[model samples]
Target: MTQPLLSERTLLEIAEHEGLVLKAYKDSVGVLTWGFGVTDVSGHKVGRYDTANGGSRSSIERAVEVFEWLLRTKYLPQVIAAFRGRALTEAQLTAALSFHWNTGAIGQADWVQSFLLGRRERAWSEFMNWSKPKEIISRRKAERALFFDGRWSGDGVVMIYDRVNPKEPRNPVWSTGREIDIKDEVRAALRKAGSAR
Candidate 1:
């Protein structure tokens, strides 16, 4: 049987799956804080330039910015290519788009390039596996679960991938300069990102 792809809603859910503490509300450490990054992908700290009220914006808002950034800059192209001109169901396209938005086909943009080229399951696995923390294996495992949850059509909670931490500048860097699609794949990925949300 053909493996299932992610839908847009699931993609959002995947993004929201991993919860981290943002710095904005970090001062009251012993108390509750609403600021949180998406766990990994550079912005782990709370008050850095790229996350949790560190930069010109707030943390939760930054999370959304990061997700949109990755999608526009690093992941969108290959995504379009993944089903390039093919009839991918809206669900499949939206879901995969979300996966790319969060996990992103970064440093190794080729995997996504190849996924689009080959349209294989292993590529999808690689896509999911890419969501890893630099130092924590446990964190990586958790991200994997989030990414895979969308593999099949399910209601996954979607979070923001904030990019306010200087450690992670590319989180919101979209040099490609193309418009994002939420009603479809691009727009959906772009939603909740920066002012666009």
Candidate 2:
């Protein structure tokens, strides 16, 4: 059976983490951006840029539509190529997609290259090397955890697991209720990939 593409749950998680913006604003690099961190609006008439005000107004529905289209048409293909010949679970694919969306061209990313070469531990550690600001660092940590442990960090907060201070709580809601496990699913995907090989 052919594997499914990205799931709605993963899409929602990405959307929640990316945050929605109805108005176009200048990103850190001064590019006009709108609608869940979308920077390139060449083909779609959804966003317009003004030197004085930044991007034009947009609706959430339009933003979501554009996001989904880009994911399917642009990012998904790139991610597939990056992990070509490997079977990936929904969680694993989504985690890689999230990383690709945040940082362009996973094919050029050193971490991904390391992973493709079977240096699993090296690749996992390289996730932290993409750390930028605190927010991005948290996101990298969460992505790393997802890739390795099959856990998704729902609150966009990264907790440092400490065996010594095991009782120290982080985001209680995320830790207790929102965290999701897909280990069995990932293991099955790996097994399938191995068998295919």
Candidate 3:
């Protein structure tokens, strides 16, 4: 059987939560991140060296390009494997992918076990357990809503935050506060960059 692909709406959902940053910055935990919350690219952990000589900055198009690549090559596969061959609805897959992308705990997440056991209510409740750091509660709530309610919110508009000094502090995302519905731009960029799959 062919693997299912994430819907555009689903992609936008994840992107909105992750937000967009065209430059490398350290995340809440001080891990170097770039282009839609990516911490690593091709196994190279994003580092301060990446910021040297303005090497870390990228166009929005390029940022989308890299984000899509990570989703396709890394996060998607991990989510798929976590499912262990069980079929899932688009909403379920979307929620799972978003959850896994953010937390990287899909394989051991208690929510997955609840879901597999047909206790969807428990699954939704358990999903909230991953919410730590306090700031992540909103994302967990969104993912939970998507999983159980099939409600994917967000205007497809994502905030483009300003890059901060890597050593400055943790999770200090200084926003340019610029928001754009990047679906069209990302689609055009992907078309120009070649097939997304």
Q: Which one is best on lDDT?
A: 3
Tens-digit per-residue lDDT, 122-194, candidate 3? 9888999999989999889988998889888766899887655545653435655678889886676456546
Tens digits of lDDT, candidate 2, 1-197: 24346555566556656665455555555555555577764234434622133434554446656766677667877888888758777777878888888887578878888888899999998878788766688778877888778887664221221111112221112223232333233234334333211
The TM-score values for the models, in the order shown, are 0.38, 0.70, 0.87
Itemize residue pairs with steric clashes in candidate 3: none
Compared with the true structure, model 3 gives a TM-score of 0.87
Model 2 global lDDT (CA atoms, 0 to 1): 0.60
TM-score ranking, high to low: 3, 2, 1
Q: After superposition, how far is residue 135 of candidate 2 from its true place, in Å?
A: 3.4
RMSD of 2: 11.9
Give the lDDT of residue 7 in candidate 1: 36
Model 2 misplaced regions, further than 4 Å: 1-4, 41-46, 49-56, 155-197
lDDT by residue (tens digit), candidate 1, 7-55: 3453444444334233333211222222322333433433344333334
lDDT of 2 at 89: 71
On TM-score, the stronger of 1 and 3 is 3
RMSD for each model, in Å, please? 11.4, 11.9, 2.7
